[model samples]
Target: MKIRAAVLEKIGAAAPYAQSLPLRVQEVELDPPGPGEVLVRIRAAGLCHSDLSVINGSRPRPTPMVLGHESAGEVVEVANDVRDLRPGDRVVLVFVPSCGGCVPCAEGRPALCEPGAVSNTAGTLLSGERRLHIGETRLNHHTGVSCFAEYAVVSRRSCVKLEADISFAEAALFGCAVLTGVGAVINTARVQAGSTVAVLGLGGVGLNALLAAVASGAREIVAIDLNEDKLALARELGATMTVNASDEGAATAIRTATHGGVDYAFEMAGSIKAMELAYLITRRGGTTITAGLPSPEHKFSFSPVSLVGEERTLRGSYIGSSVPVRDIARYVDLYQRGKLPVNRLMGEQIGLADINAGFDRLATGHSLRDVVVF
Candidate 1:
């Protein structure tokens, strides 16, 4: 079938993406769902930093790929082997498609499924196939979910059926931002009530972390960001205090305010500098968790003595160390109950034609969670 999708022809394009136009919205052919796969009509897709990383060449992937992972859609068709889901079911697309037989999947850590990682890195579906093409040219899939189009064909393992009543725009966030952010606090850190917490980088993911911290009953929640507008929003979203990352005394101020730093610090900005601050602001015996995906070439150095003496725990969380099938449903229940006010993160709703301009806004670090509404 013919579909309109955003294709990243190349990477490392100059910014002012509105002008450089890295992603070209063009017509492409999509194949039918294979066994264990489903065809979905994409209702909404969010522009996230993970996508931005590819555009900026910080997180390199195969190019000429359809560039979307965070999305929600209605099932239109299901392959024969996929008996659990049917047409008309609303679902959020997960970037990693776990094969149940993999070691990580068996250990309740589907996010690290060996086969999923291989397929994602190779730009293929769990079945190791490409279902998109332009005449004789085959395009790579973005983490097995090329969802920046009217339709997508994804492995059944890449979807979490949504039982909650919510708009597609709201459900789209659960796939990435909400899962990564909320899961970081609830799943990764296991933040206890009355514990102090700090979150670095108030983007969609970071702000969601703030919301989760509040829901978890954290005594003091500190929000840090370079953008003043974002800091203001953080304050509105239940943060006890907000700090500008650029301030010279930002670390000192946070340490002083929280009485020698917070019990848990999260780095969601996908920058080495943010990671540094997240570590610096963590108190003795505290934990620092980073879900940020900086360039693979980038490295962060720290003193082992601090880890030994302070008994500090530094961990890296991918997909918030989440089990998507279980966590997505739980998080959605929280959202519907008015505990996780994720709706406040919604920014501009745009059409596919304006995608380049939308990304330009994303690159500015000023936009909220912008979604492409079909």
Candidate 2:
């Protein structure tokens, strides 16, 4: 099959996202799934900060790569031996696919499966072949799903079908931000009722973290951010208090609001200083979860002696430590039950030609999620 896609021709050159993506509409061949694979016709895709990370060279994606990870669509075709999936099934693509036999998978950590670790990062299929290419240039697609275009060929394990009631636009993010934020609370932190939590940085992930904290029954959810617009949105999403990070006395104010310190703190802005503040404002034994992606050279300070004496837990979570198949459906249910207002998180929906606008908005802290609708 042949389809159109927005290819990142070179690195460091700015894409014309406000008007167009410099996306040359090229037709490429898509091989039928080998072993366990599915071909999806992408409907809607959530524009993630990670996608911008690759284009900006922070993630170091190979030139001329097809970079898209979070998306939702329908199964147009399925490979033989693919059980529980068939053509015409609506599905959400999981960037990380579970093989079910890997060590991590056996330990109930399917998101950490070995196959997805290297392959997903390298922007290739498990078979190590390029299903997307133009002429002799075999472009590397991001993960199993490259939904920046109209269609994506992914592993059957990566596709999770949704109920007829859930909209594709909303379900698109279940593959990334929603899972990362909600899963961190439900599956990773296991936050309990009456606990106090602080979320540093009110971005897409931060907003989800606050909502998850509320869903987990945390009594007080303190939101920290420099954007007043986001802080207002955070409040509606269940943040009991808001902190302006730009203020000189923000740290002291956070401590006061938490009644000395919070039981849990999440750093989602990917700022080095935010991470430090997250650690500082936590109670002696409170947990600190770093959900953001900072620069490689960025570093923060923490006293090892105090860290040990306090018995505090400092851990990093990946995509909310989620099993996509199980958690995506659960989050969809959460949205239906009115516990999560996912639509509020979306600031706008732009076409593929204007994909770069989404990234620009994120860079300037002007938008929540600028979804890509094919």
Candidate 3:
């Protein structure tokens, strides 16, 4: 079948992406769903930093790849072996496709499924196949979910069936931003009521963390970001206080205000500097969690003595250390009940043709969770 999709022909393009135009919206051929796979008519896809990382050459992946992972769609067809889902079912696409037999999957950590990681790194589906092509040229899949198109063929393991009543635009966020952000607080940190918390970066993921912190009953939730607009939004979203990362006294002010730092600090900006700041804002015996995906070449250094003396815990969360099949449903339930309030994080809705310009907004750190509606 022929489909219109945003294809990233190469990486490391000069910014002002509206001009460089790294992603080309062009027609491509999509194969039918294989066994254990499903064909989905993409209803909405969100532009996230993970996608921006690829465009800026920070997080490198196989190029000439369809460039979206956070998306929601309606099932159009299912492979024979996939009996659990059928056409017309609304679903959220998960970037990592877990093979149930893998070690991580068996341990209730599907996010780290060995096969899923391998396939994602290789830019293939769980079955190790490419279903996208342009004549004789085959294009790589983006984390087994090349969803920046009208349609996508993905492994069943890469999808979570949605039972909640919500728009595809709202549901698309659960696939990535909501999952990563909320999951970081609820699943990874398990933030307890009355505990002090701080979140850095305030992008889609960071703001979601702020919302989750509020839902979890945290006593003091501090929002930190370089963008003043995001800080203002954070204040409205129940943050007890907001700090500008660019402020010279940002760390000192947070430490003083929170009485020597927060119990938990999350780094969602995907930058080494954010990670360092998150670590600094964690009080003694507190934990600092980083879900940011900076360049693989980037490294962060810290004093081992601080870990031992302060009894500080530093952990890395991938997809919020989430079990998508379980967490996505639970988070959706929270959203419907007005607990998560993810809708407040939504930004502009755009068409596929304006994707390059959309990315420019993302690169500038001024956009919210912008969606491409089909």
Better of 1 and 2 by lDDT: 1
Q: Which parts of model 3 have CA positions greater than 4 angstroms off? A: none
lDDT scores in order: 0.94, 0.82, 0.95
Write down the lDDT that model 3 would get. 0.95
lDDT of each residue in 1-374, candidate 3, tens digit only: 99999999999999898899999999999999998999999999999999999988899999889999999999999999999999999999999999999889999999899999999999999999999999999999999998999999999999999998999999999999999999999999999999999999988999999999999999999999999999899999999999988888989999999999999999999988899999999999999999999999999999999999999999988998899999999999999998989999999999999999999999789999999999
Instruction: Assess candidate 2 and give its lDDT.
Output: 0.82
Whole-structure CA lDDT of model 1: 0.94
lDDT of 2 by residue, 229-301 (tens): 9989888788889988888988898888777789899998888889998998998888999878776777888
Candidates, ranked, lDDT: 3, 1, 2
Q: What is the lDDT of residue 39 in candidate 3?
A: 99
Clashing pairs in 2: none
**Angstrom error at residue 356, model 3:** 0.8
